[model samples]
Target: MKGFKFAGIHAGIKKNDQKDLGLIYCEKPSVAAALFTRNKVIAAPVILGKEKIKIGVCRAVLANSGNANCFTGNQGIEDARACSKMVADCLDIEEDHVLVSSTGVIGANLPMDKFKTGVPDVVQQLSEDNVDQFADAILTTDTCRKIVNRSATIDNKKFSIMGIAKGSGMIRPDMATMLAYICTDIHISADDLNKCLSAANEKSFNRITVDGDTSTNDTLMAMASGTSEAQINDAGSKKIFQDMLDDVCFELAKMVVKDGEGATKLAQIIIKGAQTKKDAFKAAEAIAHSNLVKTAIYGEDPNWGRITAAVGRSGAHVVPEKIDLYFDDQALVLKGDWQGTEAEKKTSQIMKNSEITITLDLNLGQETDSFLFCDFSENYVKINADYRS
Candidate 1:
């Protein structure tokens, strides 16, 4: 966390005077790597940041919420560029050294006048203790800010990794309307950092789902300041750094799901004994994305039929008679046959908990995969319906 400064302020981008702008700056240019949304309709900041990050060096990250800065054509791109330039000029850094990100409703333009007046003040207020404020500023519908810290010691050298993320809805496996900024004090190359970020992301962001929607503004960026004196140039040291980074990202991802809009329960769908790992993930994703299954979980109903039906249509190779299901270790179905009313009663009780695991086994092969998701509730519908209001 050292060598990094953060600032968050109300830049008039949101209507309620909430903090809508956040800045993360390093003492010097740092090795940077990033991943953006896979959505075809990408946002303006994403288009610009994608090119800047390819240079593998960055000194600052500027983000805003409440206006997505998407679909406004050339003006949106110019606005993103102008914002980056403002931050760069204020901080005495190159415009290309700054990465920009925005999240909120689609089809709205960024209010450049706000950034024109606010970026300088934000730069002046940057402090190491304001990370919580930055985290809050990046949120749109998220109920709480997600921040995670991790440290690792390798060969007597200590390294710190801190990550902040914001998300509540429009979530899916390919990423969500989420924005994650990760900063570390370790010394590592951009290539190695990218490898670590991608690998960590696969097990974290890529496995979480809220409403099965991938946002156009989804992004996860990582920067290493090289302040720890720990050179992660070897396999063993790289593994240590990767593991710590993975832990930070995984914790943040879980926070996003736990704070999912109108979410009452966090469920882990574990698929095992599939014909292949891909098939396992397919079945898990299908079950996790099922509205019927999510609503049943919300209502504490042990609807095994919905689960099996989702898996059957997931295109995953499975023998119906060889399937088994469990709700938090309580068997609901054995070899594709219902265990009856008593089992359902116990499974329903399991669903009452804030967190539960749904495990499915296809007695067909040995590959497996898992996904983290949340239950759907009436409030979710209400939240989206009144989002713009």
Candidate 2:
């Protein structure tokens, strides 16, 4: 944290005249790990970044929002490389030592004039205390900044981890629909860092959904500078670090869902008593991604039928009559039967709040899983439909 410098600036790429460029630079090379979207039609920066992260060390990262460099074919790749090379030449680092990422509207060409003008200003203004500005620069439709920081002790040595992310729409994640950067001061090998990062993302980013549409550009990168010298070289140490990293990523992931565009309610879809853990997650995600369920939450309508229907179509084995559902503490359906007028009233009031929970019990086994999601509103449609305009 002491040696890392961050900066953000408005480069005239974003139409709103807000900051859309960011940089995170280390005085020296740092061990890095990253995850990108599994979508076949990926962005140019993501394709370039995968190769850079394979080098195991990176000196700086350049990211831009409001114009994703995807689907422009070979020109897109050239543009992405040009951005990185510009940073490398200016910072005196090798081009391969610089990583690049982009977010926002896809299939558009990058504005080279902005990069030629903005990158230098950002480099000049870089400082150790610009974490907030860096977080703000990577946003697309996000309503607020998402950040999490933690300090942990391993082998009597203390280390710090800080992460920031931006994504609010086009958010059904294969890796994650946005971009995130996590920095730590711990000493861990690149292989170990990648292992820990992949494990952490699977259970956190893979479980959440907003609109069920994955983006063409998505990346999550983690860097450990070994500044703390808290060596995590053994299996035991690796497990501990992995757990802590998962907790950090999971919190930040939920923050993305809670701040989802046009979202007025945060909903937790809990599926329990399934015969298998896979079934639990499938059922939970299906419910979370359902438009009917989201609209119901938006209107403060305690529609238990939508919940049951989603569960049934989730392809999970379940007996409807044996199932139970709840909206908050109000049991809307008990033993798969409507709990009547009083329960409906309670659920209606619960939906009016900013946060709500829907629990489904299969009454089969103990396997369970849950997902964090937000309700769909008119704003979500308006934001994405008119995004480029």
Candidate 3:
């Protein structure tokens, strides 16, 4: 967390009068890596960020909510660049060193006047303790902050990693959802940092789904300040750092799913014994993304049939009679056979919890994969129905 200062301020971008602008300033030009949305129609900030991150260095990050600078064509890119330049001017840093991101209502223009004045104001308010404000500023429908911190000892030296993210809808795999920024005090190479981030993201952000819809403004990035002498060079040091990074990303990813728009319960979908990792992912994601299964979860119904049906159409290699299913530890189906009324009763009780795990065994091979999802509810429909209003 050293060398990183944060700030968030109300910039009039959001009509509701909440803090809509966030900034993170690193004292030094830190090594950086990033990932952006795979959506064909990318956002303006994402387009600029994809280029800026290629410099493999960053000094500041400017983000805003309530206006996704997307589909504005050339004007959006110009606006994003103009905002980046504004922040760079205030911080006395290169415009290229300031990576930008925007979220919330898409296909609309950013309130340039807000950035015209808010830029200098937020820069003036920068503080090392304003992470909470920054976290709050980036949230849309998220009910709370998705921030996580972890520490590791590398080469007898201690290092810290902090992650912050905001995503409550338009969530699915590929490049994942919304925006995430990671800061670490450990020394690392750009290549290694990218590797760690991509690997960790695969098992975390890329493994979660809320509505099975990807966003146009998705971005994930990491910055290493090197203020701490702890470095990652060898395999052992890299592994330790990788583990901590995974923990931080996964925790944030789970928070996004749990705080999903109008979600009341979080579910873990596990698919095992597949012939390949692709097959495993297909099965797990299919179940997680299935509206029928999600609604069943929300209703606290032990409808094991919905889960099996999802897998059947998942395009994964599966044998009809070889499947087994369970809700938590309660087995509802054994070798594709109903375990009986007692099992359904037990599973129904389990589903009533705020969090539950659904496991399906393909009994095929060794591959396995899992996904985090939230139950589909009436409130979810209502929230999205009026999201723009």
Number of the top lDDT candidate = 3
lDDT head-to-head 1 vs 2, winner: 1
Ranking by lDDT: 3, 1, 2
Clashing pairs in 3: none
List the candidates' TM-scores in order: 0.99, 0.97, 0.99
Residues 1-389, candidate 1: write the lDDT tens digits: 79999999998889998899999999999999999999999999999989999999999999999999989899999999999999999999999999999999899888888999989988988999999989988989998899999887989988899989999999997853379999999999999999999999999999999999999999999999998888897899999998999899999999999999999999999999999988999999999999999999999999899999999999999898999999998999999899999999988888889999999999899899998999999999999998988
Query: Which model, 2 or 3, shows the larger lDDT?
Result: 3
- Candidate with the larger TM-score of 2 and 3: 3
Task: Give the whole-model CA lDDT for all candidates, comma-separated.
Answer: 0.93, 0.89, 0.94
Model 3 residue 1 CA deviation in Å: 1.7
Q: Which residue pairs show backbone clashes in model 2?
A: none
Instruction: Estimate, for each residue in 21-56, the C-alpha lDDT of model 2 and write its tens digit.
Output: 999998888899999998898899999998888888
Question: In model 2, what lDDT does residue 241 have?
Answer: 86
